[model samples]
Target: MSAIFNFQSLLTVILLLICTCAYIRSLAPSILDRNKTGLLGIFWKCARIESRLELQ
Candidate 1:
């Protein structure tokens, strides 16, 4: 039970970190101008692509 709790807490922290990074990325001047190699960058690029598709 203790091990399970620890794992859950670690997962929550990891998710929170990702969300914070994404929020910062959104605030940048150009979301699509950044490198699209890392995990967050790739996700951001995909999101922008999808949004563009939806607008059309």
Candidate 2:
């Protein structure tokens, strides 16, 4: 029925949004660091680099 189809479409859209949000969340820290400075910035940079290295 039309309702079933609508439900399916809604589920697909919700899944896509969840995936996109997760991807963006993962990149947020690095993106925020583009204008970083001082010790906090240095710590974040170090943590980011270590994370990337660990990922491999």
Candidate 3:
């Protein structure tokens, strides 16, 4: 139905945005590193913790 088509379109757009953000973050990680209080900062902290755990 039309509703299902609209939902799929919205989901695709959301996925694309997430992918673009991840790509940008990979290209310039320092940008996230400098903002230690934002959402990305939380993710960065978790990633650092995970890496540290893997090292042990």
Candidate 4:
């Protein structure tokens, strides 16, 4: 019973992380499309990481 409870908690955390990454990916294109500054470099790094991950 304890094992089952722990597994459920772990699964919940994994799902939450997946959702958060998907949300960030959805926002990635907008940053690249516009000529916005400040956060631009951060977004570019994320986009590069995302492309590398896709290639892998």
Candidate 5:
């Protein structure tokens, strides 16, 4: 029972750290540059193609 509690606490701390890192990265300028040229870039390209297909 005590072990389970300890494990849960450790997991919660790790999750908090990951969330904090993600939030910080989201606010950073480097993330914005990736958004313009990363997987999101490919996603947007596909979305445009789909829209054109629907219009035609």
Candidate 6:
């Protein structure tokens, strides 16, 4: 019984670590953009925005 309990606790800890790591992995890109502009740069490069800017 105690061994089972220990196994369950270990499993829970491993699962928690995996979940937290996965969450961090998911967030890492948005959190640590090497370039300050990040996705905004993509929008600026689109032709529509450029033409709209030129029109204005």
lDDT of all predictions = 0.59, 0.55, 0.61, 0.57, 0.52, 0.47
Cα-based lDDT at residue 54, candidate 5: 52
The TM-score of candidate 5 is 0.42
RMSD score of candidate 1 (Å): 6.2
Q: Tell me the number of clashing residue pairs for each predicted model.
A: 0, 0, 0, 0, 0, 0
lDDT of 3 at 28: 85
Model 3 off-target regions past 4 Å? 1-5, 33-56
Q: Could you tell me the lDDT of residue 9 within candidate 5?
A: 79
Best by TM-score: 3
Stretches > 4 Å off in candidate 2: 1-5, 29-56
Task: List candidate 6 segments past 4 Å from native.
Answer: 1-5, 29-56
In candidate 6, the residue pairs with backbone N, CA or C atoms under 3 Å apart (3 or more residues apart, or in different chains) clash, namely: none
Model 6 TM-score, all chains together: 0.42
Candidate 1, residues 1-56, lDDT tens digits: the string is: 45346988777765555565456556772664466677657656654554465568
The 10 consecutive residues of candidate 2 with the worst lDDT sum are: 16-25
Better of 4 and 5 by lDDT: 4
Residues 22-50, model 6: lDDT tens digits: 45434564442343456644422332233
lDDT of 4 by residue, 1-56 (tens): 45346988777765555555545657776645463356655554545555666678
Query: What lDDT score goes with residue 27 in model 1?
Result: 74
TM-score, cand. 4 vs. native = 0.41
- Which portions of model 1 show Cα errors greater than 4 Å? 1-5, 29-56
In angstroms, give how far residue 55 of model 3 lies from its true place: 16
Candidate 5 per-residue lDDT over residues 1-56, each given as its tens digit: 45346988777765555454455444673543456566656433433344455568
Question: If candidate 4 were superposed on the true structure by all CA atoms, what would the RMSD be?
Answer: 7.3
TM-score of each: 0.43, 0.42, 0.47, 0.41, 0.42, 0.42
Q: Over the full model, what C-alpha lDDT does candidate 1 score relative to the true structure?
A: 0.59
